[model samples]
Target: MSTAAIDVRGLRKSFKDVAVLGGVDLRVESGSVFALLGSNGAGKTTLVRILSTLLRADAGTATVAGRDVDRDASGVRAAISLTGQFAAVDGRLSGRENLVLIARLRHLRSPGAVADELLERFSLTEAGSRRADTYSGGMRRRLDIAMSLIGDPRVVFLDEPTTGLDPEARQEVWRAITRLAADGTTVLLTTQYLEEAEHLADRIAILHEGRILVEGTLADLRSLLPPAHTEYVVRQPSLEEVFLALTQKDTAS
Candidate 1:
């Protein structure tokens, strides 16, 4: 049986009169990529913050890596890493420096070795010596994620890691995320891109109006849509479909 890496029950959070997470409930299996799909102001970030112990929940309970977020905030924080929507690399530092700084902060025995290993793993070795300000969006985001792995936390929370990147850059980050899951790191990703969830997540949850409308595997979600009927006619693609198909080709090529 798969273990539950993150478990939430009746989670409620609000900012004054505004309810962000309205009695939400969720479960994420260990060593799997779980994507939370939502629109702007849908409380995705708020839920992530609560799970990461960065914010308090108004009610309900959340446990991450077997640690209760409210009662054992320190334990929960120690077992997970969070990457917000924006890359948080220091522009003044080199990519190598950024990783080394984080490893040292985590009190790793050999920060240099840790940095070097991550630099190679993220394909940033060639750019490791250059200042972070000189890196492309993808490189910076990769470095940000590398820094988050210094302590090999059990779970990772990524809040729209590809938000402002071009298609190519987004694809680059997607590969890195795949590697994380392959290495048995449980990941909770929040993304507005349906294609992203379809491509990367083992299970997906759609959040709306501060609650989960549905949660299941891609096949399960697809089953919710009406079954297609067989047709012998060729159909023209919709404008959105054309745009997506073209963009996918552009990224792949």
Candidate 2:
């Protein structure tokens, strides 16, 4: 079996005359977090959709979990899960109910048991009986991610998972994503948040103009830019630093 959880080469896609993905190449190692960063319409979503088998590529070869994306799509689907930008849980259903419903749909032998276990894992046990509509944005996102794990997939694709979330809520989801990687699940994250990539990804790729502008460890990428000069003194921390500090304090308390 191939050691990579996802492998793609010469990937191309188009919508009519405009090319979306132009000969892209990527590799995601097993049990690590790989973040794809791009601005709006940079083909991040198209790349993710193709890799997850939701959309087919125009040309080139790709594989997920050792299964060819085109020729063995069923195997690819079986080994991976996708969580979109918005939460997909049913607001009318209780948190536990939503999970059980997905488990049952997946034909698990004990849907209720699976739901209960996931609730505990996600720290949702206390709110499991509450309607999903009543949960906070963070809680709802956690529940959505829990649903994706019902099949115990080897690879999980998170497409802009923290979009529209408050800083605290975003941090909550970040912790959950970090936990997923710690448990040996390969994570493919597509996002506009550069800080998120720095926080969670083992490797990062910047997609621009239908191609990867750069790919490497965070430190490696930093090296490409001109070195910073230590000639100035700051009177106060930057807004991002203050925000992070405040959030960390809130979380600690």
User: What's the C-alpha lDDT at position 14 in model 2?
Assistant: 99
Least accurate stretch of 10 residues (summed lDDT) in model 1?
228-237
> TM-score of predicted model 1?
0.92
Give the residue spans of candidate 2 off by over 4 A.
234-253
Q: Tell me the TM-score of each prediction against the true structure.
A: 0.92, 0.92
Per residue, candidate 2 scores C-alpha lDDT tens digits across 57-89 of 999999999999999999999999999999999
lDDT of 1: 0.96
Model 1, residue 45: C-alpha shift (Å): 0.4
- CA displacement after TM-score superposition, residue 171 of candidate 2 (Å): 0.3
| C-alpha lDDT (0 to 100) for residue 45 of candidate 2 | 94
Q: Write the per-residue lDDT of candidate 1 for residues 40-99, one digit (tens) a residue.
A: 999999999999998999999989999999899999989999999999999999999999
